[model samples]
Structure formats: structure tokens, C-alpha cells
Target: MSRHFYSCPLRWSDMDAFGHVNNAVFISYLEEARIDFMFRLAPGDGSPSFSGGSVVARHEIDYKRPLVHRHEPVTIESWVTKINAASLTIAYEIKDEGQVYVRASTVVVPYDLAAGRPRRITEEERMYLLKYLDDDATGTNKSAEDAEDKDALAA
Candidate 1:
């Protein structure tokens, strides 16, 4: 399967005393990338989007390597990892120069803004997500070679 990438520049303030990006910063970057991906599946032309509401029930990350401040771009690749009746698990890979720096996953629950609780996945959203659904018959997150530390980044 092909991966989808969203590029973002490293901010000067993202660095820490070690001169490398802080561990927590990677999770934030992943959030931005995931939002962009979800927004693309939203209905309407940016006005009445279908992005009603979603709560992050779980989030976890692992720092495989440190990234230094650089002018070169950082690429965040994300895709659907798994889905259940009311939750969706998304996996993200943050890399530089084709080498991985961090891999993460976020468990999100769709909420019906009016109903005020988790809701079932809509057909449109499911179809969009299914496009990138991981198909590992073993039922483990280690479904891809690049995702060896998959469960380590799960909450």
C-alpha cells in the first residue's frame, strides 16, 4: 500500500536544551498531520465540513532517534491502522531523509456533537479510512516492516 505524507517545517522553538526536538513535540506534529488527513475526507468545500467531533482516548509515541533543528523538511506519513465499532486507530511515522525518527498511534472516537457521545462510523468516513486499512491476518500491529515498534507506541 502507498503511504500519504504531509510535510511540515521544524520550528525553532521546537528544540530543547539538547538541541534536538523534544519528545513531546513529535506527538503534536503527528496530530497536525492527522487533522490534515481527516480534513481531506470531510464533506463540503471547507465550509460545512463533516469533521464534527472526535476525542483522543489514547495516544502514545516512541522516540527511535532524535532530530536536530534543520532547514530540510520533515515528513509525517499516516494511515488507518485499525477500526472498531466506535473507535479508529491511526498510525503515524515521522521521518527525515528517508530515516525514521518516531512512530506513533492515536485512538480517536467519533462523537455526535448533538448526541454528546461516541457514535458509529459513517459510511463515507469508513470508506475513506478503509482505503488505508492495514490487513494483517495475525491481528497484530506489527503488520509492516516499518512498523516493528507499532505496539510500543500504542496507549
Candidate 2:
């Protein structure tokens, strides 16, 4: 499966007193990439796309290195890791110039706004997500899945 890539610009305000991007801001970059991948491609307007709605069920992140403010945009590579009946996981890497700053994944549950509840993945949405599924993720997807399962058990 091919990964979707988004070029994310870093804002000066994203930096902290330590001269690096704030830890919390990295999640925003992940979000930008995810929306480009999962929502923007297909229109929602009563279509079988995520723009209709989805919610983040959980997040897992590992900060690998620090990133400072820069003119060049960082590349965020995103792809689907897992697909459950009512949810799907998307993994990401915020990196540039051979250096990785953050690795993360978000579990997203498709939402039925009219029904006011989570909904199952439709055949169309599933097919769309399957295009981004990476079955050879070097064990990272397993770790993400394990973390989600552990969190579920706890909840």
C-alpha cells in the first residue's frame, strides 16, 4: 500500500523556550496529514467519505528528536495500519532531511452525526482505507494495535 504524504509547514509559534517545536504541536502536524489523506480526497456531502465525520478514539506518539523552526516544510507520511469494524488506525512520521522527529498513530471512529453514534466502516470507506493499508510496517502497527487494546481493556 502507498502512503500519503503531506508537506507541513512549521510555524514560529510552534517553538518553545527550548528552541524546539513544542511536543503538543507535533500532534497538529499529524492531524494535518491525516485530514489530507482520509478526508480531503473524497468529499463528504452525503458521500462515503470521512469528511462526513470521525472522531479520534486514541493517540499514541513517540518523540524521536527535536525540531526547530525552519523555512522548508517537513514531510509527514501517513498510512492506514489497522481497520476494525467501527474504527481505523492511521500511522504517521514527521520527518525531514533523513531525520525523524515524531512517530505516531491515531485511532479514529467513524461517526454518524444524524444517529449520534459511532458507525461501522462502509464498503466504500473500507476500500478507500485499504489503499493506504501498510502490512509491512516493521512491527510498528502491532505496537500501536497493542497499545489500543491495552487502553480498551483499561477503559
Candidate 3:
């Protein structure tokens, strides 16, 4: 199993009155990461690939810590958690200096633009997704304690 990592820059505009990143901005971070992964997996060359695009069926997010604006980029790690006939779940973690700030998942259904309906994932798409399959039984790549320890060491 592998993880797709995207380095997202934190903007001053992302912060709210409380001085932490606004909750709504977290979704945009996840979206940017997902888009990067999808583009890497399937370049939009008009081929019958997952790059055709997908619709978000569901989103689940757990904010572990409030992220303050920083010059350093935050890292978003994404991987496939499950793949069904027409949908797949993508798990993500937003981390800075190895400390996780948010954990999330998004269920997306492959969509057909021409037909205006959801469609099954092709074999090629399935195999590509399997490359990033989350094999950990706990469903998380790293424990909170582990992340904290790594962050401490990095500092």
C-alpha cells in the first residue's frame, strides 16, 4: 500500500477570528489533495480512466487540533480505504511537522459526464486505486501517539 501526499500551503486568509484555520478551509485542503492524486493516477487525456471525475457522496472529518497559519506547508496524506462497484472511500490526514491536525474520509462515486449518471469503476481504475489501498486493520496509517512522538523528535 502507498499514500499520496500533497503539500498544501496555509494562507493567512484561511484563518478565522480565532486565529486558527477555518473549518471550511479544511475541505478545500482535502479537495486539493484528492485532485492531485486523481490527476497523477489518470491524466485527463480523454481516455476511459477515473480521471473522468467523481462526485462526493459523503465526507467525514475529525479535527484533532486547530492549525494556526504558518509559513511551512501542511501535508495531506490520502489513500484508498475501500472500493465498491461504483464508489470508493478516500482516507486523509492533514499534518504539519509530522503532527496530524485532521483526519477525514470522502466517499466518491465515479460519474459519467455524458450520461449524467454514476458508473462502475473500470478494471484499470480499480487496479490503480488498489495501489494505494489502506491495508492497516485499524484503518489509520499511524496512531496519534506515534505522530506526536515523530513531531516531538522533528522539533
TM-score of each: 0.83, 0.85, 0.87
lDDT (Cα, tens digit) per residue for candidate 3, span 1-155: 88999999999999999999999999999999998987775766655687666899999998878899989999999999998999999999899775688889999999998899999999988898989998862458467556765675687
What TM-score number comes out for model 2?
A: 0.85
Task: For each candidate in the order shown, give its overall lDDT on alpha carbons.
Answer: 0.78, 0.84, 0.87
lDDT of 1 by residue, 1-155 (tens): 44568997899999999999998888789888988887787754653333888888998786777799998779998888888878888888788776778878889888889999888888778787888776751222555644645543562
Enumerate residue pairs that collide in model 2. none
For residue 144, what is the lDDT in candidate 3? 58
Ranking by TM-score: 3, 2, 1
Q: What is candidate 2's CA lDDT for residue 47?
A: 70
* Candidate with the larger lDDT of 2 and 3: 3
Where is the poorest 10-residue window by lDDT in model 3?
136-145
Question: Residue 44 of candidate 3: its Cα lDDT?
Answer: 60
Q: Which candidate is the best by TM-score?
A: 3
Please provide, for model 2 over 37-73, each residue's C-alpha lDDT reduced to its tens digit, 9 standing for 90 to 100.
8875567455767766899999999777779999999
